[model samples]
Target: MAEAAAKQRSPATPRPVRCIVKLGGAAITNKGELESIDERSLRSACAQLRQAMSGSGDAAPGKVMGMDWSRRPGDPADPAVDTDGFRGMAGLGIDTNFIVVHGAGSFGHFQASRSGVHKGGLHTPLVKAGFVATRISVTSLNQEVVRALAREGIPSIGLSPFACGWSTQQRKLVSANASQIIQSLHAGFVPVLHGDGVLDELLACTILSGDVIIRHLAQLLSPKYVVFLTDVQGVYDRPPTDSNAVLLREIEVDDNGGWSVVKPVLQGNKRGVETSVAAHDTTGGMETKILEAAAIARLGVDVYITKVGTDHSLRALKGDVDTSTDDWLGTVIRSAK
Candidate 1:
């Protein structure tokens, strides 16, 4: 009977995606304010994304603002470049099949933290109320994001992890209906997922972070590249607020998943960078993002971390920016082996 049941189940393979873009909640929303979105930032990010995916015919040529727009030799032969039917990037004509995952930011964090939702134990009324409140806030933000994308003619569908049978055990995601996301991608619709409160076996309930979700999806989809849109320029040797902090351009991960900065080694204080998480944030913040990026890098996918609504970010999303060039103001994580 078990063999018959196994044979009855059909296998679903996800299509090859060109890129996965993670919109940091801090980048799109005002973290200092409760449930407030940075409208200007969100609109700009959506516009830039639209431009990157659909291409801009009027963009300046031959290295605009120190970015290398110069077409590489035999560009048409690149497997990543596809111009058959889909709208391609300007000058490059590259097709981007991408997904967007966003953080909860101020929307759900306040509720989750206040009620100790991350701590679990759904037996309490406060925890249950917090779960509902968190979902309502995050899903509202998701709707706003999807609407913004729609305004730019991008077909986007929001998938709530909590509503979609994503469950965790001991705060670790054990199962998710990834096929729904894959099917959405195969149908040419952008699947937008977010950090959410999910049912847990051991804890009863816990926060499933967007960073963790990105890492999970990357492992399953194996996209060519992943881009993290942050509020800052990129990963720095120390906290970016510090005057002596320096941006680390490239990080290489070994076969065993260990990583080291490969460009512009730090001159002093190599004791590792210190990151500060928001008081109300249930998630680990920037530190978690870096850890997830490293995990994705270990899977042989290049990851780019850059500020949203910037020229470099737009280029990175379009898959045209060369990471080796010093002009690109971002951190890229890649596999060493």
Candidate 2:
């Protein structure tokens, strides 16, 4: 009986994740671009992400995507959340990984604004100035991200899209260092990426978003889940009000209302660079995220959009939920059968 009990108590194998999690800036802190990051909340969120990627126990093993990182030298301030969380998670023996991709927080917002980038839309008098400014911010942010990761025992490194990624005339990424990133994951090292400075293409410069890196990761790794943690609780039925607003349980790709149901506010600082995210399929907002997640579902991926709340992040990563609806704790985006 003792031997039988021992056999039953043997440690179970871990579950492999075909998942990619996109942690938004808002998810890290209340301060969009104006305020500095909240280390406590940020660290906790990362710790949960680590838990999900961790092996066995209350947590489940996974291949966590970018944990709030900037791969460039000039990127904005280092986010204490992801960097610190990675350390705590490392203590638990999880294989933590990240694809560092971040935006220009305080760094470029002013320069980009003054140069008149966002006002003129894509390219204008402020365009060149905006691009240059954007680069600086990205580098600064990346610097901080790298520092935080190093403080942890994850042994991660930075990667640049400007150096490695190429785009087609059709606005699609022609090539990227997907293989190298995968190699890092295989070796137990996290490969960080960020909203790149400027990638000179055939015609002009291409502004990269974390979404770009996200799509690439989804295509290459084909993780089992994709969790998007943001400041909002989840996609809402009309932007949330302290008074009354509904938390959507699930959202199907083919659902009638779609992105029309939720409004993505451009509540960033006055000095931020703006991207035009169309109602249709495009990168940079919820619409884009939902569409992309749906596309990845063909490859069998589960996508979750939730807030960066205290314990919720861990539950999402561990696939611990009690709802059959699309969005459980948050809005769930799924592909139609």
For model 1, state the Cα shift of residue 233 in Å.
0.4
lDDT of 1 by residue, 22-118 (tens): 9899889998999999988888887777777766634643221111123445776433322332343344232436789999877999999889999
**lDDT tens digits by residue: candidate 2, 94-168:** 556544444443445556556654333345546776767766766665656555555444455676667555443
Best by lDDT: 1
Best prediction by TM-score? 1
- Candidate 1 weakest lDDT stretch, 10 residues: 61-70
Error of 1 at 238 (Å): 1.0
The superposed Cα distance between candidate 2 and the true structure at residue 250, in angstroms, equals 1.2
Q: Note the Cα lDDT for every prediction shown.
A: 0.77, 0.54
Clashing residue pairs in candidate 1, if any? none
